[model samples]
Target chain A: MLKKVHCVRLDGDKAELEDEIAEEVPLVIFVNGKHFSTAMISPQMREEFVTGHLFTEGIIDGPVDIESLKVESNTAKVLTRHSTTFLESRKVILSGCGSTSSFLDKKKLPKICSNLMLDRTMVLNAMKAVLRSDNFKRSGGFHSCGLFNESGAIIVVDDIGRHNALDKVIGFGLIRNLDLKDTFIATTGRISSDVALKCARANIPVIASKGAVTTLAVEIAENSGLTTAGFVRGNKMNIYSGGRIN
Target chain B: MLKKVHCVRLDGDKAELEDEIAEEVPLVIFVNGKHFSTAMISPQMREEFVTGHLFTEGIIDGPVDIESLKVESNTAKVLTRHSTTFLESRKVILSGCGSTSSFLDKKKLPKICSNLMLDRTMVLNAMKAVLRSDNFKRSGGFHSCGLFNESGAIIVVDDIGRHNALDKVIGFGLIRNLDLKDTFIATTGRISSDVALKCARANIPVIASKGAVTTLAVEIAENSGLTTAGFVRGNKMNIYSGGRIN
Candidate 1:
């Protein structure tokens, strides 16, 4: 996940330094033997990312919808039980942080109905734990996400893209048959509308971030009945919507 | 570019606080009367973003390739001198931070050829100038990019997406008929492979960022002859590729 490279450091004095950088690889997904999309990822957790990405993008209802998933090199071949007509019709390439092809209709999103409530200390600890990764600390180029409950973090993933990280965590939960509604997510990325929408689509109740929350994200969380929290650092956090925090 | 919202601030004592957040809107692009893509942007500099995006995505060679560009609300209607066959044939949704449709063939990318050299002071100053944005400070959700020469920052743009911010600055330079080969870009986001490719596509010789650089980004910069610098914090920087800095 990390590659060492020689760099010239300019800090009052010129010094040659070796730095570790995160690796980014293009992961191509094919559905029903047709090309779907290609994502530049951190090259780990390919199956989880593919599974979570398909679910979050609304391509598949759940993991059971996939008959088989095979990852060869950088390509993921997914054979689903459903037809490919839905994929062909909705080819709209939607862009946010990078470019996603998911067409997000706010009204169509399912409102979260989980009764999961988190305390201030738990949220802060989750944020801290999710961010505690050797890859991120070494490379400083990865965004991290984790699924957590009152006990601790269940699965933590680090990716070059925050969206991919969250998707990987969601996929992990789906594969493990974990109750996603009873869990919350903590991330190192901003709580954008897309991020909030992903949690809603996955039926995750709460999302806390170590960054700021966008206004559209706040609105979507409010309408979707999802709890959104941001700035989870040093015992301080701002709750944007769905006051389920204790 | 910003919106005010009510939130619950959680420190030691819970208090109701009014906060400002960055606005994200979907900007749909239509090329030659065909639906191209939709980008979630910060709702500013729509025209510049369109121009820069087209060029960076290799949709148009330059600003002259576009016959007419019209923006209504969030939709960008572009009439190009070229045929839409290129768009139809290459419908691959390439995802990095989000989803982009550009098929990036590293061998096909144009090698940047420029004699632009920068002193340490100038590069550091440019990074500082570009990051000095009121929107980012207020909303804390903006990724900023700037086009700079020895004189200082020519144009600085802030968006929810770093790719959009860089594209906006590139578009600004394209419209003004500026010599992009002589200028560089400064960004507050990480220097990923897509970003390095964007600068190379725009014929920009250098890109400096106050963040980390991916390994693929370093390879792309080195191969394309583009100067890539990262970790441009106070009084320090790391030169990853193209040693054009004194």
Candidate 2:
């Protein structure tokens, strides 16, 4: 995947730099030999995306349920097989593009838990620390997603796609066997349905994005009991739903 | 939708000025009483996004088969109670996060006529012209997409969302009854499958963007008879496929 990266940064007209590296990656997914989708993502997280996308999309539930997940780095093929009726109903197919967006099942948003409390100082302090973890400051492109426990320290995953970043966190959580309850998914990208859905899929209760939030995302959070906050910079933030700041 | 907008222009750590105005005009889609997707886009040409999304995604054939295409200001929604099969298999969705990305059906790309003649230089020049069309210089955040004929002038759309911008151009083209063939779509974002599908959806043979192209997008264009190019900034570009430079 690094071999396919064509780095051509222009200074005036000519290429300031044109090099091949494993940077921008294209992953094509096949489900049951059917072309599921092709995504341009960081090659590092193919399996994570597979398990995360399949699980979060409600395609399948857990790693054990996934029959197998394979990635061919050169061809960029991510083959995923499932062992459940998760792909049942054959109801909706949406071509969701971006680091984070609302994909589907808006009605399934998690019920907001009532006992959680967010300390403004903790959240703000985390922002300053999160900025240091940005891979974008090094690569010039990429979105970062973080997961924090009740104490709000940055558990970071930086990737070219914000969704990938979230998946990395989810995967990390899975690996560490951390509980998702009362946790929050924080990202540098906009809080859309896709982002909210992933949090709901993980059963995380609160989401905070340093960017904007779509109307549908707000509606999904409001209706489903998931707490959402956007433009969450400094001491002030817009509470789109779930009533903490409100 | 305007109520969902929060504006802030910062020289540093301050909200300096804030107001809800119709600044980021682009495209958004709704399906069956739910907000499906929205992209920051040019307001003028939205119907095409509404139509092109359907076509490239294999949703519908022509505009007449659809029920209604409507746009008020920056919001565009195309609705159809089509053959139920198309609706049911439509769970996987693509919503561009105001950023051009690759998240589409690569294995099922549109087949072009194969006899189409694409003039590369003309499209590249149009790409340069597109840079000046952005209101992003004012808003500081937005992407633009345009469709141009052989003459090199284009109908351009700018938005915070690259998908919306492209959709606006498509929408505008449909309303004007414009023929997409011998024309090209130029964008200030990446040349990804979703964006490439915009041209393929319009049956346009060429697409040029002032950014990178995903490997899958290049593959789709090469096979779809759609010529693709990327990184067009002031007299330079790399031809990804399907056109003669002369």
Candidate 1 per-residue lDDT over residues B168-209, each given as its tens digit: 999999988899999999999999888998998888999999
Residue A159 lDDT, candidate 1, scale 0-100: 92
**Looking at model 2, what is the TM-score of chain A?**
0.75
Assess each prediction's global lDDT (C-alpha) against the native. 0.84, 0.59
TM-score of chain B of each: 0.92, 0.73
Fraction of native Cα contacts reproduced by each candidate:
0.60, 0.01
- Highest-scoring model, lDDT: 1
What DockQ was computed for model 1?
0.48
The alpha-carbon lDDT assigned to residue B222 of candidate 2 equals 73
lDDT for residue B89 in candidate 2, whole number 0-100: 29
Worst 10 residues of 1 chain B by lDDT: B94-103
